[model samples]
Target: MPPSLVTIGHATFQSQTLGDLQSGSLNIFLPGLNLGLHAAPTKQWVIVLAGSIKVYLQNNQSEANTAFVSSGTSGILLVVDTKDVSPVGHITETIEQTALLFMPTANGTVPEHRVLHNHVCAGEDLL
Candidate 1:
């Protein structure tokens, strides 16, 4: 049987008034979506809101490791040591699609919550 559709809500973040909040701008990954192997300088956190997927990592010794992540699951906090951190294996989704949130860790900086849709006040709805 196919997996049921999950209703995942977006998170809200605190931003300056001058900043505009973009909604529905999230990138969705369908089944069999290949996010070609790539690496960054800092560590990254990937949150899966829906569906499941497999992840492969290559070590310095040319060795590779694999990990599985389920729906509503999160990937390990990985710090890329080199510039070309490529996936040694493939990631296959167990479900139809997966929703993921990716954030990079930096110098004393943290990821913020972002709402998917805008919420208007009662009186503002009339405008």
Candidate 2:
């Protein structure tokens, strides 16, 4: 048997919007897709409106850490520190042909909501 991939569930979570609220674009990712390791272009929040996605992230502490999110999963993604002295950044993939809302940050500044663990586990845990 293969390792079961994590699937996020729906539950209430306390959160505050980070960036200045403004109109942004909507993106749709198809199914059976595997996106390469990459980072957010600027400080922004990625809201999973439909379907699910798996975020692959690595920081100074560990590698191979992933957060699975479905509809209602949202988080603040910071800029990738790819400097020679820094660790490699993270990546994301559309697990269920996800639809996303890219909420832009204010003046490209880091949001008030800090990325405590360099990654987020939004939404609920799937049973």
List, residue by residue over 103-124, the lDDT tens digit for candidate 1: 5554413344343322211222
Residue pair clashes in candidate 2: none
lDDT of 2 at 95: 76
lDDT of 2 by residue, 1-127 (tens): 1123443486544434444654477999998687675545555666778888777665322333677667742433334344332346666777777788887666665545334453444443222
Estimate candidate 1's alpha-carbon lDDT, on a 0 to 1 scale. Answer: 0.42
Question: Which stretches of model 1 miss by more than 4 angstroms?
Answer: 1-25, 59-64, 73-95, 108-127
Error of 1 at 62 (Å): 12
Off by over 4 Å in 2: 1-15, 21-23, 59-64, 73-87, 118-127
TM-score for all models, in order of appearance: 0.44, 0.62
> Candidate 2 versus the native: TM-score?
0.62
